[model samples]
Target: MAQVPLVVGLGVRNSIVSALLGKGSEKFNYLHRFLGRSIFVASTLHVAPYLHKYAIDDDFVAQLGKPVISTGCFGYIALILISLSSIPVIRRKAFQFFQISHWIGMVILLVSLSVHVPICLPFTLSSLSLYFLDLLLRLLFKTQNAFLGTPAVLLPLSDGLTTLLEIPSLTTGWRAGQHVYVRVFHPGMGLGKMWESHPFTIASAGAEGEGDGEPLRVFVKSVKRGWTERLFGFASDGEVGTGEDRMRFGGAKGGRRCRVLVEGPYGGTGNILFSSFSSVLLVSGGSGITFSLAQALSLQSKALLGLVRARSIDLVWIFQSEASLQAFMPYLLPLLNNASSNKTASSFKALKINLHIYITRPSSQFAYDPSLSTTLLPAHDHLYIHTGRPNLSDLVNAKVEEAAMEAKRLNGRGVNPCGLGIGACGPQGLVRSLRNVVGGLKGERMGEVGGVEVVTEAFGV
Candidate 1:
């Protein structure tokens, strides 16, 4: 009963929890899971003594038959199911089942819990009230305007392994690193596909100069054999076999048009301002570049307008294969060119930008554009492309040292430097590794760099 409101608060988007704690669901979902486990353990402890007493008194069967006891037993069963199904491996493999079962289990648990213990009614009612209020407000404001659907274009890329979604009409603008939910309408794909909404990070930094009126972009990688696979197929002319088959039919250039509901602009660097830092580092792995790319562009835009305290911005992107580079060239080329131009701009104190690309696997069919290699390669001082995985710890330390040196130089000229901000958005492994590296930074190292702040947006539930 005591944990009721806290559980609901942690689960809901617009709740007192978010208001007081200032963290969105994306940031604190792990805490919700922890509290849920606590509820399960408490429920178990409460039930054990009741069962022991009933058995000792020899009224076990009779007591279990009562309405209160039966309902409590059912609620415990529901809680067990919810807990077991929520295991990461099971949840990822059977997401729909997990999602459906969770909601159903919650309903059963809440109803039975109230009936089993009348004293818990007030607490349960309060939880329900908070949940519904969150739902009502989310529907009325945040996700309401997008229900009717907007025209979207889906273009397959990266040897048909990824689909680029372009929603040109969604020009309302969004914060850097934020994501939105997209529900596409495909008549032939069945009702499940139509009703389901998937979250994808916005790749374009929409409120800025060049980004104004630019379509909201999302790079959907075919990582699983589920909704994303189906979406990739829909975008790639419904090719059934191998990736080569899809590409053989000129699917890369073929663009599919459909309407989709856009439900967010949620989950970003909430109160942390990128412009407030003296140096910024953005890191991403695979498709997670969408978040980092948007952040980099937004920071650059702010710097150009002299609205930022940042003087240096570094972007580190890791790709599994060289072929993946082709899909991002459209965005990468322009960014490199802009960074190169910024270096020569004498009149403005422009942000020094550096782009580091690390390709972990180099296949024989390496599809890098020859023109880009010739033009943007060694000539561009800001772009560095390397083979093999990066030594993240070493790289971070290098940046810290560089920032510290620059701070000392600036201090001699009577200027104090702000802190270094590190933002990472990627797979669990990458984010975890980065976090460990940042955590290891101790007293002198941290202070020499003014200070260091870390923000992360990790993939997965």
Candidate 2:
């Protein structure tokens, strides 16, 4: 029974440490760092009592006179220095020196902790078990591509954004809206050297009858500063040189050169084709449209397979500029055309996909069509173009509610009141906002209406 609290406390500490090391989002990283400091405090508290007991009851002071005790004491002092140096004030004084010393202090801490806990069978075994589990998980991921027989190909699109990639091995076929983990391999950089690998939707796959030579595509956009930027470099072009020189210099040279290791095509906006819902509403911000684009393509392909029938798909992509759309046109144009042609042939029965591009930062070079309006959209749906960054959550929520109301007005029982499945991929804050909006509506509309689903993909930690 006494082990219960200890287990719970250790579990909490483990969670905090894991979050600090896990991939995805700056918010989580900040939380991890904060919680790591708390763990240090807890660890200190845990060790203090044992030390006190040894000193008072066991006359451990006599043992302290030994050389080993002197070494351990110095090690503990170094750990304190490292902790203190992590404070902003001290770190700012000598950043490089502090970083090197921090590593050294970590070595001392690990050695001291091992010695301090040695022969304590329970604690040592527990720690070893956790360590081995982590190692096993890493090993599994490292060999994933070999077992899956897929090679990850990264393509750097212009506009300083990597919006496309190909996986040659996933020829068994991947569904639209499914995401995979990508780890960049940098030679001479050592194993597991690739920083945080984030999830991106498989925007489009090769034709249904296509061979294994065909590659799966993934879309990505760059954030200000993060692990993605560190590994891939800030510039998307091939200008970045390989080897240590590149890491030292930073940024790509002529084109983006990065090797990626992919793992698991997991979780997405629920299987759209198999769902009973007839309509889908896809609302995205900036590069967040990746998953939506994939889903739209998936639904079209599934319809061709004669699997399920969906009424219409309304896609709203909010971007900072028209360039974003044009930049991704190589991938988007085909999907759009297919959806359009299929809708016409089916007499707008099986599936209808309409694209609405919202330009938040319209430049003087690009002119807006005066005749183009949101009302220009079809009777059951429409395309909306905005000049500036519109509130994505508000727009999506309002659109969903409007679609639901329209469905009810038509006495349609199959249409979900929550509207359509919403899949988003982009920066963390934007994703969080969308999640909150979805969460708020989960009980009110989403729970009762089986039509809508929300899927999100974040960049990195």
Candidate 3:
């Protein structure tokens, strides 16, 4: 008999049930909330089993009078409030009021849960670690916002796509390919001041070494009736309007700064490239190439500074259309030119970096010469561009396998070297795909090769 998946066997059966029930349009957000509730219920059950085993014999009710137990009681109460308020019935009945209360209840739950955690030093240390991580990301975000000079700014990119943002700072340096969270306040929509935040990669770090102190640039494609359009198309200037206002005007007037909360320079592992890997293969979809570009530019910069040694770097950027490439050109051109010039000047084995642009959608304006070498010259670093979107799962898996094969090829000659580490920053689906591919490669070898390591950066939760 085939063994059941560990997730189902562990009693976390939601995934299995969802698959059996047909993962149709129940909405993922709702499913997420439901899963959270289920986790909370499971935690409650764990406590109950212990309570039942000890309560009768030890008089646990009397022990509950202790401060820790009292705090846990408050936590339980807060959880109830969170659960009840999160219910569709309550939310539908009084949407606005429920929304307001829900936030407050979540805050209370977080606080109570923190207190309910064990008072042991290890627990405290773990809590502190999370707190510091949040704090550091917040600080970096705030600094970026301030340097931008306005709390926020809304503008259009090359295409009709719009981006609404607030940056209190822009002077704190940001590497290329890093992303920031964008929050949109739309007036008179659904509920009031109900803002939605999402991550967008920095198109360019904004004219490196140029002392103008301008805001960092980001490229965003509007999707249906979402927060980006609401903020970019509606919000009034300087009015602190509701979601409705943002949906109408695209921006507020009178210098009312966008109030943005920034978080994270978090996940690009720069150390991977510094290792003894012979070559680097970077695969990205849509705006996901921003992180790869940043690494390439950083590597070029390091080469310029005579910092480290590397063989070559290859970049594969895949997007839906030529328009997407055009939108990214303002940022990408400079980096490419810089790398090209650096190659010309360096005799120290030029770090060959090749860029391949793959446009999935065919358009008259998007055609490229087929003769273009994906390789960076002098070192003959290979660059291969293929049109059409590669299945993300297949691409990740193939890359892992290829890296292992190459490692084995080198190892057969008695020159075993660490394989390239894959890094990606993208949407949930892509990140999840890459993560799975990485997990599968861990401890698996190709031929006589060493293993492959993958690094990823995911936004929000």
After superposing candidate 2, which stretches have Cα over 4 Å from the reference?
A: 1-38, 48-115, 118-154, 173-178, 186-201, 205-214, 220-260, 266-279, 306-310, 343-350, 370-384, 406-420, 439-453
How many clashes does the backbone of model 1 have? 0
- Evaluate all candidate structures by whole-model CA lDDT and list the values in order: 0.78, 0.55, 0.53
Residue 262's C-alpha lDDT in candidate 1? 78
Local lDDT at 6 for model 1: 84
Best by TM-score: 1
Q: Give the TM-score of candidate 1.
A: 0.90
Candidate 3 displacement at residue 38 in angstroms:
7.8
Candidate 2 local lDDT, 1-461, one digit each (tens): 12312332233212333345332222233553464466457656765885788778886777678756655566567657776877767665555456567658755654565565454345435544654564465447433553333454444554555535555555544556556666665542234344445656666654554323136666666644544444434224345336554333222234344445676555444333323453566666667677677767766665655544445666777778666655665555555557556655543334556776778788878765546532222222333455767676676777567656656744565433434566666667777887787777655565434456665666433
Q: Cα lDDT for residue 126, model 1?
A: 83
Model 3 TM-score, 2 decimals: 0.58
**Model 3 score (lDDT):** 0.53
RMSD in Å for all candidates: 4.0, 8.3, 11.3
Judged by TM-score relative to the true structure, which candidate is superior, 2 or 3? 2
Indicate the worst ten consecutive residues by lDDT in candidate 1: 241-250
Evaluate model 2: give its lDDT.
0.55
Compose the digit string of candidate 1's lDDT tens values, residues 1-461.
68967887788777565556444576778788899899999999999999889888999889878999999999999999899989889998898888888888888888987898789888778888888998787677667255677787777885568888877777646878788887777864467876777788888777755436346888888866677877887777743335564343223655577777777767778778788877788899998899888888777766766777877689999988866776676676667666557755545566667889999998866544424646324346777777889999998998898888878877888888787899898899999999999999987878876889888887778
Residue lDDT tens for model 3, 1-461: 01111211222212333335432112133455655577468658856775786566897787677767766666667667767776777765555455566557545645555666554334334434444554464555433443332355554443455443434355346655456555543343235334554567664443345333335545455656655555444432334555564433333242134545444332235344433454466666665676676666666655654653345666777777666654465455555566657666666544666676677886765445546533221112243445777766666556556666666676788777566656666565777776776676546453224545565654323
